[model samples]
Target: MDPRCIPEKFFDIKETEVLVTRITGGNVRNALQDIHVADALFDLDELAIIHHTDCGTLTWTEEIIRSKVKSFAGKEHWAEIDKTVYGAVADLDEGVRGDVKWVRAHPLITEKLKKGTQGFVFDIESGKVRKIDV
Candidate 1:
């Protein structure tokens, strides 16, 4: 996770106030690896999904990565990576919508967190975060 994205300074929050995890959008949207979070945040209140401009996940689509990996990293390597979702986003608003939808719909997260959910778009150049209305 980039400090610039959810910086402690963003809300004048102390360092201990947040726990950041850097993952592909697919992980968020598909709810692949959230068991630990469900346990850890059992007493949590809210959640936020922040997708940013110029993310590496946006550099390549899952289809493109699937097609090219064999040639670039060999067949075995491609097989290992094939199961993963690239989590690429071509449109920020729509991507945020899908991510927020999934998060809201996730069975584990829905029950674990009870208060609020928000999505955001961070402008890499401006170092600004804007809320996306879901």
Candidate 2:
């Protein structure tokens, strides 16, 4: 997570007021397990999938990231590594929409949660977050 991309400050919210499941590219695919757990436990009011401008994931392809990791983690773990989603992003708007759509369609996320799900793009330059209608 980027130090400058703090949702609390960006949203003008208190630290304990929100439950954030932050991940690279803000991909809901990577946060499904956490979403499921939270859905089952908490009465979450909203699910905001926030992707930002100039994310590192935008700089490289998934294959390129995997190749670099393979060089360091060794081929022995390639199976697991290959299975992982590196979350390489292209367009910020498209990324947010895809994640929101994916999460809303996921069977594990409750219907209530899905209905409440929303997408956003955090403009790193402007320090602002805008909602994306899917």
Candidate 3:
């Protein structure tokens, strides 16, 4: 499934176990660390890291994006806009790999969780999801 579509559709089911985490500053590892620390009570069977094609987040550098926004809006708004853009531009593959790596490498999750973690790449054009060998 498309990563962008997951929240609106996959997460809509009431029975689904969802932990909505928004990691800012484009730091995937830091975000997962926070989740691991906070969500110890829940039973996490598998981790799904989804990335899509044609994602606007992948385009543009932090400085350029901020400058463009500031040009249109104002200099005072650059900081907030830069932070938001960075958060969204957090690479999907990197985020997924970091999360799974953390789960497998960390003593906390590895000790309690028996299921192995994996990553996937979703192609929006072909509508196919393939396992990513990282």
Candidate 4:
């Protein structure tokens, strides 16, 4: 499911335009570049970076995960699963911090999305959302 497509009960806005992209191999920089180009062409307002809990991408290192998948699935699946798990330890605070830092540091998105843009970490256990300090 697209993270942007998820319903927000408390958070209200005029409208939202969803840019659904397949993010694989942990290449967030390239993905943000594509989104940044689209945003510039369209004149977007704000950007939100969302990383969910229990995401499979956080499970293993790129090499280990790829080898396992290749052994079970096929060699073709290696490229798509080559995502390094930097800080996917299920800590809400740490995850949010890492994600926000990554988005803010991205060259394509940094200028467009300044302090106005923000990062949020959602806790499924407590049903709460908190802003992350990048």
Q: Give Cα-based local distance difference scores for all models.
A: 0.67, 0.84, 0.56, 0.55
For each of the candidates, give the backbone clash count. 0, 0, 0, 0
**Per-residue lDDT tens digits of candidate 4, residues 6-102?**
4354245335545544443223444666766867787655666555555554565556655666688776765666653433234545655666677
- Return the TM-score for candidate 3, rounded to 2 decimals: 0.52
Displacement of the residue 67 alpha carbon in candidate 3, Å: 2.0
> How much RMSD separates candidate 3 from the native structure?
5.6
Q: What is the lDDT of candidate 3?
A: 0.56
In order of TM-score, best first, we have 2, 1, 4, 3
The best candidate by TM-score is 2
**Candidate 2 minimal-lDDT segment of 10 residues:** 36-45
Of candidates 3 and 1, the better by lDDT: 1
Which regions of candidate 2 fall more than 4 Å away from where they truly are?
none
User: Best candidate per lDDT, number?
Assistant: 2
Name the TM-score of candidate 1. 0.73
When 1 and 4 are scored with lDDT, the better candidate is 1
Residue 84's C-alpha lDDT in candidate 2?
A: 78
State the displacement of the C-alpha of residue 50, model 1, in Å, after optimal TM-score superposition: 0.2
